[model samples]
Target: MIRHLVLFKLNEGVSRDEERVRAGVRAFQALEGEIPELSFWECAWNITDRPIAYDFAVNSAVADTDALKRYLEHPAHQAAAAQWREFATWVIADYEF
Candidate 1:
């Protein structure tokens, strides 16, 4: 199995905090149902006091590295990511088990 985690920080005035967080949560949650290789999905809004923290985030579980790769390259994901880039600072990590 593989875990793919991503965090995003929206640029100043680029997005409404609440709405952007909600959309990120919904988009990740929907991936499990929409993407065949997505076994699990979770998203959250960061509220910690840490200065370097991201604003919106997603954690996803996949069956394997291949699945993870596919998810990253998926058209839907690409489109969403493009939109995210317009308003975000991004970070990503992948783990295997």
Candidate 2:
């Protein structure tokens, strides 16, 4: 399986508690059932108080690279990412496990 992980840090003036951010987070959370290639999907707000911690995260798994590609290219994923781009910056990693 391919484990795809992403961490998002809100932009300089963005707040996690704000309505817009929460809505964007919910948009991503809703993708679990929308994308057929995803074998596992989890999205959450960061609870840690550390300065280095990201504001939000997504941990997902897919059958293989092809499935991972499908997940990334899915319309729902693209839309959610475009929305998130407005208020955050993110980093991602993918690996076989």
Candidate 3:
């Protein structure tokens, strides 16, 4: 299996409470059962107040690299990513397990 992790940092002056941000969060939260390649999915806001912590996180798993690629290229995933692009920057890591 492959693990796909993402951490998002809100842009300066952006607030999590904004309607756009909330919608983006909802989009991501909706991805679990929408994508067939996703075997697991978990997303949420950060609870800690530490400076180095990201504002949001997504932890997901797929069967293999091909499945991971399909997940990345899926239209729903693309739309959600585009939504985040307007208000935040993110980092991702993927590894086989």
State every prediction's TM-score relative to the real structure: 0.81, 0.96, 0.98
lDDT comparing candidate 2 with the true structure: 0.94
Q: What is the per-residue lDDT of model 3 for residues 11-84, given as tens digits with 9 covering 90 to 100?
A: 99999999999999999999979999999999999999999999999999999999999999999999999999
lDDT ranking, best first: 3, 2, 1
Q: Model 3 — which ten-residue stretch has the worst lDDT?
A: 88-97
Considering every candidate listed, which one attains the maximal lDDT?
A: 3
- Per-prediction backbone clash count: 0, 0, 0
Q: Work out candidate 2's RMSD over C-alphas.
A: 0.7
RMSD of 1: 2.2
Q: How far is candidate 3 from the true structure (C-alpha RMSD, Å)?
A: 0.5
Clashes of 1: 0
Off by over 4 Å in 2: none
Prediction 1 TM-score vs. true:
0.81
